[model samples]
Target: MKGLLYLSLIILIATILPLVGCNGSSEEVFKGYQLPPEREEGTTVELVIHETYTDEEHQVFQTIVDMFNEDNPDITVKVERIPKGAQWSRLTQALATKETPDIARVEMEYIATLADRGTILPMELFWAEDHKETLVEGAILSNTYNKRVWGIPDQIYTSALFYNVRLLEESGSDIPDSNWSWEDLMQLARKVSDRNPDVIGLSYGSSLWELSPYMGSYGATIYNSENKRIEIDSPEVVKALNLLYGYQLDVEGWTGSPIQSFINKDAAMVILDSNSIPKIEDSGIRFGVTKLPHGPAGSVSNIDGTSMVIFKDTEHPREAYEFLKFLTSSKIQALWADELGQLPVNKDSFKNVDVNKHPYLEIFMEQVSNVIPKPALPNYSQMEELFNMEMQKVFKGEKRLEHVLMDITSELNGETQKD
Candidate 1:
């Protein structure tokens, strides 16, 4: 009887030990890694990014990715590059096929479209509780649609007048100022233009979006917000187009490119987005940046930027959100903006010593505060296409300003009706 009791106790101890070990192992697996706060474990996320950036920019992005991976080993992020111009169409097709990346770098103009299509997940809860003050007001609104915040805005671009300071001084022309009017701008262009049979006074890339600020200065709206009708035929829009066409005709050396123009410095003054600043700085030209010249009504400028968004199909929404939050943090943004010459979306990032020391950085930041976000409409893609086509006709001098305006209004109205 004593031997049987001893044997039974031994068997009970063995069974209990194995069960305890199993419980510990299961807990370890569940507690693998801690992502931000709300993420789950054992999920891998994929990110899609633009292939347009320079090698240096890519290196910066990779460094950020490495930091994220170090902190969250259980959640892996794989990045894929897509061509810049093809990014939107490719993302659209992927979402349709249920292959969307967990996170995507999207254009600010497309935020509304993505939300409308249910491709993006709103991030208001994440941003409002942690990063509300970190971002600039204009940038935050750029990613907001119908009161829903669908993305985190990371970088920004604002239109500025880029002038060859040396050329302007050589031609005995005065530099433009914030108070300069449309007529003042025209005179300055005429003065700086190389009318010697080979030079033009001013050159613009010839897009309606690029020219919209000029139209806005005259109090023109592309769409009647209250009436919900296309208003490209407004008299103000016609006047803006005529002024743009005038530069091509009256300025002796003004020209357009079927291919590339601004990089080659084909014109004296170029109104370009802020992204082109670094390229122009590297060109070894002594350039100066000024506020975009004002028009008859008031001073106006357009905003351009990229937003960081998480797709609705992401397998690791929590992990992806953490990574995005890191990317948009003020500290990281300051480092990236100062080193890369890309404007930071965070207001405090502008206060960094290095960024403030850059000659053009302060001006760009000031402009960021005043610039207007593009129309956040689901039909913007269609509107952009029609606007570009009509503007091309005006640029080629094949259609009068009034005629192009009327045609664009008619076509846009038809599109809106269909929607």
Candidate 2:
């Protein structure tokens, strides 16, 4: 498989895409077509961006693109929005066929895979040294692969412990504080459930990288850097998994999609990111956000968000890069956060945005350091699939904790990748 991946990108482009009627349209006709250069006033770059965001979210981004066009008359950025889950698959196919957009907004987890395949342009191609200090370190580290940054973070991403304060109060439980523990959280969960049996006690996330938040609390890591091993079979991990399993067995809690379940009030408390705050707000439930409860190891969480990367075959690399840089500016970042309920990659912007204006965001900003970048593992894609499959078995009470851990660890240890 590794050997097959080494064909020169140029060869792939020449043989795969016929350059005749390849006018960027008709993916079926010009199946691998890209827009030709515009020798006009400004460089016109096509950007493909997708998210689970509402049309309102896309409108905010269009506003940003318009702002960029107004200031830099020499650059034109055309934006296209696609749905999230299918975005990465489509982008990969496009790259393989040499028909790719000039710019793509990618999830940070996919950046390494795309970069390793030489599909995305390197950040050093555009990012200035002075700009380095202006952004958060995690954003840089998240985009780095093979010692070169492959993308620039458009949004600083992190999650908080979101709870329905009114529900907790009604259940006669005190609201959680910054220093709360996992035990405290569980107790609160049980209380809310007992008080309102119709509503669930918790909504645990079963999404990609969802398990990371609980692992560290018990002094466990899915992948332990110190020993250079995947620790799925470790006692700490089993304890963590069982804790969640216990919740499901006890109260009929846990959902495949925590964010939606939370919005529906199917669960009283759940782990959520600031990006989902708008929906929670619109749900008309009195709620608040806090740092996740700590375990013996301390409070730790995962940062899962998207970044913007330029495709290597872009005709307008400079223009696309300029637009990416423009998005990083403090004022523009603040606007992005204001429109989209996310944290700013620029640290200074955090101070400028009044929390009163964007509630629950401050908790996200405060916990940024506690939240680590998804492991820079090249094979994380494969591991995520395996983890989810194994977890489902445990959730259904079909497998014992020790037996499942052993299987997961054995599978992960046998998988190998080249650096």
Candidate 3:
């Protein structure tokens, strides 16, 4: 009986020893080797993002990713840089493949198209009421279409009046106040140019995007999205076009890249967006930025921005939303706006930013609150090109203002009806 008991005890000991070692000995082995600390135990998720950003923006964006990864050890965010003009094409192709990125940075204008194609998930799926309240209403509205929110706005911007201080002083004109009208702007322009014929009073582009604020101030609209028609030939639009063309024809100035002209000191006053601030600062030009001059509709500007959208087919929708939320958080939004010279989409971000240091941001924020966004139509680009061509006819003296306006209105109306 003792011999049998000893054999049984030996067998039991042998069986239990390997099990104990399997449970704890490996940990001990790693501890003895001073292995790096174990990673947080979770299913690691890899999220691929497709984005198009300038070199400077790319650097800042990478830092944002790194910060996020530090906080979320289980999630690895990978960004693929798409060329500036190739985002849409690459995105469409990716959608056809199994390797579609989890997130894509799309322009405000492309949001509607992506939503229409059902390529992106509706924001309602992930956004809560509390989250909705944190964003700027105008920014949220720009991302909404068909009564559904489609994208999370990341960056917003609008144009503001930029004036050269020395030029204004030499022209004997007082700095324009917020309540100044088109007439006031005209007077300022005239005074500045009259003082020096070599320097143009104002410099601005004639593209539809550039002209949006001008048209809005005069109570003109290129497309009536609610009514689904073109209103470019309205009396207000014609008046606005005539007045602007007259400025260029009667006033002394050039009509190309506004920022370039301003940097070259070829113009005393220029209509430019916030992005132009750094270039102007680099040029060492003493400048002041203010709201655009008022018109029949009061001070007006057009809002636009880049947004992030999640693919409908993304395997990790929850993780992707976390990132979008992260991007739009007050802290991140404020940091992005401060570094990129962009307007923040999160209203709460203002608390962290010092507008005194970035005075132009204040003007931009004010403009964004009450500005008209570009119509969120899939074919907006097509209409923009057509309007550009027709408007050029008036500015180039190739066609009468009234005639060009009539033709553009008819053409755009036809396109609207086709939709």
Candidate 4:
């Protein structure tokens, strides 16, 4: 009986050893795609990354990872794709369960939240002193909170005013340009709407993010981060909101769904970001892109992007940091620019781009100089939700603009205290 049991145990070990060797020596497969060989003989350090990228983008990313893996034979990187819409929820749950990946691609807005939770490693600890200078303006600032950068920005882009060329010409309106002011935009939009009542003059939203540029132009900011207080109920904010409200009220602007309205030709002009360009082009809209009309604060728009962050509890910190650096390298940025039309975060990559090949980027490049970084506050999203809710009430005529602003100011200030 003892001899028979020993032989069975020997057979089990023989089967398991081969499976372990196969797993360590063979190529890694994920999501039905095979990756480069992950050798068996080294102290294999595996770094997992959670990211949201389209299938084509993932292929490009996989190729990039293969290059990195070839250069560093001891390290193997694995990407876990998360649906774009569910990224935040999935990441939060992972953090709570302590099952988070070594690295993650996070939106700029979530940097503060993750950093404040002490779940993300600060970039300042691993990065060189002058490294921040290599990125484009506001790139590092977007991920900065509490005087430290929590992530390395991988993408940066801002919005511009998109006008229907045919509508502008048919209405006999002067072509809009970079130097155009808010008043100039309003006048043009009104003229176009009057010329054709079927079309609204503008397509926009009342959300704090959308209203931020106009608010800044009017010399009002949503929050005073330095003072740790809300500043959204000021006279300047009211003035800005009232001007936008006037446009909507007077012209019956299509604020319900601005992008859709622009697609349907119901809106003569729309404020949109780079992501909207492909859709607009596909819809066959004869459009032109220009800077958002200058506000009192100049022609500033909201600047934000996706950034790479290392989880604080990651076992492979050095490898993760190295991978973060690789992702932000000029070569990688240029590849993203060429393949995905992503606005490069690296200043060197931006300088080397062929603007003639990507003409829309030329307009974005012009606007990049004039952008306001979103406030890096832990409760920013919560504040944004409350502000948007109040603003919607004003838009629906359920409350006056001044009353709503005052209420939001109080409510958001209370939220800040809780934070």
Candidate 5:
């Protein structure tokens, strides 16, 4: 859904691109439309900080804002907190008016889309001015293309297998280990599903993002990083699809709306990220997390996070850069990770908290090391949609796996030329 929002904005902007400016000079419209000009320099610069965070979650970030303002009296930072679900529409609406916040907490996947639009300012602009060490591990490379960095990773998370301990025990299934194999997971699922007809073995979202852990585990790669080409028609990917297909048709696996079903005891296990701990903790469901079972390739999980980026059009580049640097500083990043139970990107932040001390976190911390990231490409949003459609066809038995994969690879590779 979020990927569609990015595609929609890009399409909308391209359709109504400006032909010229008010000064009678022909305006140069790049792929993203146009690069915004900087605002006039002033002693006191006012900046707007936009990001999607709940009122409760806002406190964590707001505390940082307070610290920034106190440290730098000359710069004023305003906070704009939007609900995560509404971010796409809100951001699209603002971009329609050619307006964006001075700085925003954007998802790593969105960097390439925004950067291509020329709305995002390069991170290099602040490299010389600020000495902040950016946190990049577990961060998607969509923000870094052609040797230019777009944003600083603020928080990182990887997908893990979360099992309901009580549900597994009730179904007479033993809890799986951290090094369990795919065969082991399947066997456990069969045992649990046989006991509970209404309950499924596992629940996960049916999309490229959710399917990534399984795909990577089986060595199914969507992109060839070396050649920058889409290559989805490999034997490994086909096998992975057949496995998921079996789970859906033969095993009657559950997909999507996982959190509620997991809490309701309708599913024995669910694949989710660390951010889910707060939800499961309050549901009174005794749960334990472990790394995804190893497939032919190896155990793998998908990594995602929010990145802090500045707008190229900001009037106060220097002041905004100062705040950007402050927001991404090791001191602030470490504190943020500890307060939120999120994975830190900065190397220094790692030592501040013993991730193993927290429940379920130690499992996630280990899984984070063996993870895969979403691809960073200008046409990524569209490519994601293509996978969703093609994968569904295979799952529903409407298309042969081999044929679908071939079409996807050709279609995606062809899309690159169009761009």
Candidate 6:
């Protein structure tokens, strides 16, 4: 009986050992090497933005985010708006410290520098992979850098000539049409100027961004592309400056106050972007918008507004790309444009919407159709600073127009050479 029991135990051990060592030709070892399944939803993406507008505008942005989240339950977005006047510097610091958010709102002028520094991701890869075609041509070109697309334009604002319709009618001067020349505008301004001692003829913003288009339309390039030189000293630029300065000084009651002065009804006409339309409408003043006064070369206007860009350091690049794509969609763009009083970049949004329905908006949209984007170079901000300082000197009557421009051109050329 003992021998039989021992034999059974040995058989049991042999059976288990063979199963554990199963490298035999009849069976295969179970080596665990497959990846775990992906999560049902994507991670939350963080966005850094600026509180540049009113609380209502911020609420609209929140509404858009809420709608996006409702449609995509698996993904979420968190927006953090930096304090006013500090967004650009703060964002730059974040990039330097490698602490950038997943996405950010950027001005068109700043996009080139951020892209050149590799702080923002190129959207070209996502655009190609998704095969999306909602973006307009002007927007695509504006957000691109060195042949690589960097962002999606969420909004666009272009400058137009806003005049008091009543003032124009009373002055016996007709508002210039799209084909009107600079000389025609000057004459109208002079006529309008003689109307009231308290009303200035025209006003433009103090920033160089607002002044560059007029210079460009005179067939003058601020910076020479090939030689990397500043060319504001050219005869055309001096002539353009002289014209602008003449309006501020020679025209009766012409005060050199900024564009806001015109909105306060202190000036007969003002050069402004679409952003100011809502304010102008709320002021209870009747106004008419027309294409910018033409210069020697032709009519040209500068484009302004914010764009949505994905940071290169974002944890969820694909998700960020998707959100940007949705933001620029025609439907969403039209809704935002209509509500916010911004001109929609989509040409289709204008259909069925009478330009006269919203008197100022109609004019703004019309002006947008003819705009030319400014030079989107990496050094644009630096160039703008120099240009503004020199222009201020000229405006203050402290320096000759030719001397101020030539000095600035030389200084800018020197800076570019060091680059």
RMSD in angstroms, candidate 2? Answer: 9.1
For candidate 2, what is the total of clashing residue pairs? 2
Query: Candidate 5, 200: how far from true, in Å?
Result: 2.4
Candidate 2 structure quality by residue, lDDT tens digits, 193-216: 888898777778655467777876
lDDT of candidate 5 vs native?
A: 0.71
Point out where model 3 deviates above 4 Å. 1-44, 252-254, 415-419
| lDDT (0 to 1) per candidate | 0.66, 0.71, 0.75, 0.75, 0.71, 0.65
In model 3, the clashing pairs are none
Q: Which ten residues in a row have the lowest lDDT in candidate 2?
A: 19-28
Q: Evaluated with TM-score, which candidate comes out highest?
A: 4
Error (Å) of candidate 6 at residue 165 is 2.5
Predicted structure 3: lDDT: 0.75
Question: Can you list the residue pairs that collide in candidate 6?
Answer: none
Query: Whose TM-score is higher: candidate 1's or candidate 3's?
Result: 3
Model 5 per-residue lDDT tens digits across residues 1-419: 11122364345334322211111111121223333355445557789989887666589889999999999777889998878878778777877887888888877777766666666777666575325443555473545644467777767788899899988998988899877987788878878888988778877666788888888899877666666566677788778867876777767674547778898888888888888888888999888888899998899888887788777667766677778677767788768777777776665556666565565666776787766666656656666766676666666667676776765565455432221
Candidate 6: residue 138 Cα off by (Å): 4.3
Kindly list the per-residue Cα lDDT of model 3 for residues 1-419, writing each as its tens digit: 11111254334333322211121322222233222233456779889998888999999899999999999988989999999788878877887785678999889888766765566777776777877899888667777666567788877777889989888888787998788998888878887888888888888776788888888888876656566566778888778767788887887354757788888888888888777778888999998988999998998887787889887777787788888888888899898888877788888887777787787788887777667666665555666666666566567776677766665555444432231
Better of 5 and 6 by lDDT: 5
C-alpha positional error of residue 234 in candidate 1 after TM-score superposition, expressed in Å: 3.3
